[model samples]
Target: MRALLLSLLLGAAVLPALAAAPTDPPTPPVPSTTDGLIAQPWYRPHHLIGQVAGGQGMVTVGVGYTTLRGRLDVDVLTGYVPRKYSITPMGIFTGKATYSPWTLGLGASRWQVRPLSVGGLVNYTASRGMNASLDGKYPKGYYWWPARSRAGAFVGGRVAYELPTKANGQPRTASLYYELGTNDLYLVSLYSNIKALSVADILTLGIGVKVDL
Candidate 1:
């Protein structure tokens, strides 16, 4: 009778212990909100870009960063123009920013359209033979604008095709874009001779491509 009572008591204790133990898997720890942003290195660019003919150079290549949910892109580019196009071979360094207010998705397709894009650029041209505004050859105030530097604004559009997402779930894309732009010098000339110089005469067209990293 003593042995039997001992076994029963043990059984009762084990039954309650087993019932209290968890059956379901432990809940996973939640991810921190800033984990994704903090994981990315600051020097890593969001995209790589290349372009042709926008008064910057005959050919330009660069890297860019995308922000504000891909609505804004800021880029830095290095451009080259052969001697055939200038007195000497010229290298152009440019910094630009582009903003696209809207993105429209094509129905059930990977294509996306940015119907309007507005941007501005500033560039400095370096060439051995190029005249500098501050050079002794030009008297003070003789030229109001810097000959080797130019600032411009453009309006353009882009079409992007989305690719597979990265391991981290960031989307990838390839895009083709076009820009119509004019420089400050061109604007000044146009203003001085509005009747003789039409908007088309001062406009420059640039074509380019961008690939998301």
Candidate 2:
């Protein structure tokens, strides 16, 4: 009887020790956060500026974010075009925000011969599906002789494709796109003034690099 009692005591001690052996609580699934949402290859912010073939220069800076569902991008741009024959300068500043497939943008600009102006842009992306965009702007300043307040409006469209890649086991992606558009200026003075400005139909192209954080 004593041996049996001792055996029972030993079993109890061993069972408790086994139960107390550190158990790895099931790893709580790693909490997901907005930080995770920003870890995509398209999430990093970037800055780009360059001069076109005609001596016109432009600068842009922006950030982008993407997830399994969709994406968002916002950017600011400033451009300058020197007068063809005079010492005056034409300048523009714009802020653009967009979602995949559709784009919306607004801008303010000035000219050596014109007043402060505001403008809007709208675009559609075709490669990603059926998407469309719309934008507008209003000028706050004056224009040169014979020209009224240089307020203007613009509309545009584009097609884009995102190519995904990997470098050293890290995610990387790039985008290719093309756009076309037209602009209208509200110059109240010039009797024969040209209000409609056609954006030279050109293939707007850009390449970007992204990193996951």
**Which digits, one per residue and each the tens of the lDDT, describe model 1 over residues 40-121?**
6889998999999998789999999887667889999999999998899999999999999898999999999999999999
lDDT of 2 at 114: 12
Model 2 poorest 10 in a row by lDDT: 109-118
Give per-model TM-scores.
0.82, 0.35
Extract clashing residue pairs from model 2.
Answer: 113-144, 115-142, 117-139, 118-137, 118-138, 119-137, 120-136, 120-137
Task: Give the runs in model 1 whose Cα sits over 4 Å from its true position.
Answer: 1-39
Off by over 4 Å in 2: 1-36, 39-70, 85-87, 102-170, 184-213
lDDT score at residue 203, model 1, on the 0-100 scale: 96
What TM-score does prediction 1 earn?
0.82
Candidate 2 lDDT (Cα, whole model)? 0.33
